[model samples]
Target: MSVTRVELAGRSYEVRVGSGLLEDVAVQCGPLLRKQAVPIITDANVAAYWQEAVTGSLTAAGFEPHFLVLDPGEATKSWQVLEQVVDWLLDQEVERGDHILALGGGVIGDLTGFAAAILKRGCGFIQLPTTLLAQVDSSVGGKTAINTRAGKNLVGAFHQPSLVLADLDALATLPSREMGAGYAEVIKYGILGDHAFFAWCEENGAKVVAGDAAAQEYAVDQSVAAKARIVAQDERETTGTRALLNLGHTFGHALEAETGFSDRLLHGEAVALGMVLAARFSARKGYISQDDAARICAAIGNALLTTEIASLDLSCRGADLVAHMLHDKKMDAGTLPFILLRGIGEAFVDKHVDLAEVGAFLDEELAR
Candidate 1:
């Protein structure tokens, strides 16, 4: 297992990556467990695959394991669902110092992390990220959130975990489509700011996508390291430095809103398309030449992100897409800022951008 750390002000955590981390979770939590009983928050789908193994491990290590099995899907990451989870934790008598285990994909990790952040006015939690995206991105940053009617992750907090266990074995069971969804984020780290890793992904992304062990481990470790560096520099996103991580998020989140945040558009898929749009937009702005944009798209293409985002028919017009951006969190004083690139591995936030200009650009992309 490759263990890494995200060191922050008063909040730091270990992110352990490899196979069967679930089996060793109890021992991993030994130092944090203290007399703290462990409450596992997962949904029916994940419970089917991991409940028995996780419970046995936690129990054998002398930590009482109580669970809150929730309804599955993006709809479950809502205020109503969060209320249910909070109520369940209360029923389990979870205390402020005690830790909760978020045991599932991004949805479960996100929902549980938000719940853990607010429960008892911010308690402790752990991330047992089972999906590739969660392992590399969402689980480590402590950006816990629940989607609001405004947009994705509108209601959330910065609550770091005590430990994060990314079990590569868990990815074996993910559906191919979901696997593709995750590969988008892995490609994102490379695209957003890491030129060398981006090149590495271009070379080995197919093998990683095929579930090659070494390839998978390298992807996770490198992605986590990239994210950790960003998180360490800007933990709460108070500075624009961390905002670079939103490379494709602005466009992606708008796409998610346009689709109503349903199965029509998965977050990572939206990100994939969003990155393409960002790269293309950068070229349009003359910040990056056409060749650089082509290279970025080629790398994303090799990783299968462009096709996944393109999976959605070219039905929604760009004007329609811009309408969805109306609720974007990055907007301030009626203008939406975007993370555009000057070239590969280079990203900068463009706050002075005119919304009407982006709208015009979206029109052009949709027309093509």
Candidate 2:
């Protein structure tokens, strides 16, 4: 097991990455779980695959496991489901001292963490992220949120998890498409901060998605470590240091909205294409070379992810897409900050971005 610590002052937590961690979940989380009844929130898709292992672990440890299995999808992260989860947690008689387990992918982790955050003003929650995207990005950041009509993750809080167990065994059950989706976030870490890691990903991404155990562990561990270092520096995203983590999210969220946030574009797939757009946009702005931008796109394409907005077949124009971005959570003082690349692994926040120019750029991309 590789343990990466998110070193937040007075509230630091460890993210443990390894195989068979789920089977040993009770032992892994035994210290934080204070009561007999262990509450786990998961989506139906995940429950079908992982519920037994988690249940067995907790039960064997003399703890009664209670699962609130929800319908899986992006739509699950909503006010309605949030209300259901909060009400369920209340019925579980959970306390601030006790830790609630978020046992599934990013959706489960985000919803459960948000529920724990607002429960009795504040409570503890552990992240058992079953998906690669969650393990590498969402699960570690403490950025708990639910999508609102206004925009994605517009209504959310920075509620850190007590611990995170990223069990590799869960990846074994993931479909190839889901695995590719997860790889987008995995590569995002490399693209945003570490050039060497980006090169490594370029070489090993296929193996990682193909369920190569060593490659998956390295990718997860490296990605978690990269995120942990940043989170420790700016736990609340106050400094621009942490904003680099949004390297592809701004563009990705807009694509998500354009697609109705459905299966048509998975969050990771949106992000994959978003990074491509960001890179190309960066090149257009003279921040990065065209060759470098092409390299970035090539790496994304190598992972079998969508690398072009034109391929999405949206009826909207560039201006329409930018209209969706106006609702982005990162909007400030009527300006949206973009994470543009200076080069591979060199991302910085550009707050003075012109939305009109962005619309024009999208127009070109849409036409292409």
Candidate 2: misplaced stretches above 4 Å?
Answer: none
Clashing pairs in 2: none
Provide TM-scores for the models.
0.96, 0.99
Compose the digit string of candidate 2's lDDT tens values, residues 1-368: 88888998899899999989999999999999899999999999999999999999999999999999999999999999999999999999999899999998888899999999999999999999999889888899799999998789888899999999999999999999999999999999889989999999999998999889899999999999999999999888888999998888989999999999899999999999999999999999999999999999999999899898989999998888889999987788898999999999999999988989999999999989
Task: Name the top lDDT candidate.
Answer: 2
lDDT of 1 by residue, 1-368 (tens): 88888988777888998888888888877777756467899989888899999988888877778888888778888999999999998998888888888999899999999998899898899899888888888998899989988888889888888899999999887876677778888988887798888889889887777788889999999999989999999997778889999988888888888778898777778887888889988999999999888887787677666533345665676677778787787777887778999878889989877767888888777656
- lDDT at 118 for candidate 1? 90
Evaluate model 1: give its lDDT: 0.84
Instruction: Per model, state how many residue pairs clash.
Output: 0, 0
